[model samples]
Target: TGTICTRTALLDSRATGMFMDLAFARENGLDVQLLTHPIFYNVDGTLNEMGSVCKEVEVILWIDDHSKQVVFSMIRLGKTKLIIGHTWLHHHNLEINWTTGKLTLTQCLSDC
Candidate 1:
């Protein structure tokens, strides 16, 4: 619902969807859209019965000179504030240089 001001985001290729810390989303005054059918899971291949995902929020990502809007499902994770996962990587066709620790855009959207 509102712009996210956070700059730090972890790029996780193994993750299936973009995730945002629930507390962080609230502190930033972002609107949380409740999901009708919530899905839950953990990295350990175990069912996360604690209602892992029930809401989602939209935010804008500014990369280089281009700006793109993205949606992230809310989760209660302690490791990082935000996580850009497979959904974003595939949608934007981003390339990550592990050695240099840099991200490169492989394809440009119409807005870019």
Candidate 2:
């Protein structure tokens, strides 16, 4: 639809136009990315290392401890909640219990 459509009956001075909608997008999916300071952490969640990660169409959950980088990539991508850090993105899929501060690991299951 270039300027406007021809079927709408309008007044002589009125105007009409068309715009792109979400339904027309090719990649009909949400971009869930995380940008953060890459840090490494041990099993006890202690400081190990630090760094930055640059990614495209990917998720990362980085915990730095002892100067080491820990990156946890996600298999499934969502269309909402794009987490961003200072300069990079750290993608981490988490299912937090609203009732409690317990952190739960998210698993990516195959649809087939």
Candidate 3:
């Protein structure tokens, strides 16, 4: 099942607004649809905001701003095995002790 979630915070009116005025809108018959889906338009398509609507997400597919409170909860419960799907600024702030090798590693999700 494929899904889409747009994070409204990242919207840029300048760059996107100019793109919307281009001729390809009517030529390709896609302007109206793309107008509403800006996050996928500018950057590499791989980084779209596809998690905003999920309620009970498994393996968070961690991104730029994981809340510190959620991470503290994970630490309080002693989750020893954490798979970081992607690294960003927030990933380094997770506060788990790794120098002592308290955590264990497993294969990446594609292999699992």
Candidate 4:
């Protein structure tokens, strides 16, 4: 779904899954897929105040020369429009230069 393209995302080591802001997705015309079961936990295992995540959207994410299709749970994010969480980080084993704010894909699995 070429609904939206964004350059900014929060790379959080603690987040369990990738996520997209519900409002942002709607505002940008991203297609939302409803989940049969909703999620209620946050990165810290606390109750999600914004409510259950009952929808998701699949989008292609581009980072430099690499691009991958990702499914993101739609939720209400306080400060960010998207989050690239632990599941994605672990799979890609990405290198992040915090000082320079750059990301590099050191090694990639064939499937990705």
For each candidate, the alpha-carbon lDDT, in order, equals: 0.79, 0.27, 0.25, 0.87
Per-residue CA lDDT of model 2 for 24-85, tens digit only, reads 12143424244364324433566533222222232223222111122222221234222223
Whose lDDT is greatest here? 4
User: What lDDT is reached at residue 8 by model 2?
Assistant: 16
Q: Write the per-residue lDDT of candidate 3 for residues 26-99, one digit (tens) a residue.
A: 23332132222233322444542332211112222223433222110011112222223223222332333358
Which 10-residue span in candidate 1 carries the lowest summed lDDT? 1-10
User: Runs in model 3 with CA error above 4 Å?
Assistant: 1-43, 47-53, 57-68, 71-82, 85-99, 103-112
Sort by TM-score, top down from the best: 4, 1, 2, 3
Clashing residue pairs in candidate 1 are none
Worst 10 residues of 3 by lDDT: 69-78
Clashes of each: 0, 24, 0, 0
Off by over 4 Å in 1: 1-4, 42-45, 97-101, 109-112
lDDT, model 2, position 47: 53
User: Against the true structure, candidate 1 has what lDDT?
Assistant: 0.79
Q: Residue by residue across 26-45, what tens digits does model 1's lDDT show?
A: 88888889988787767687
In candidate 4, position 92 carries an lDDT of 94
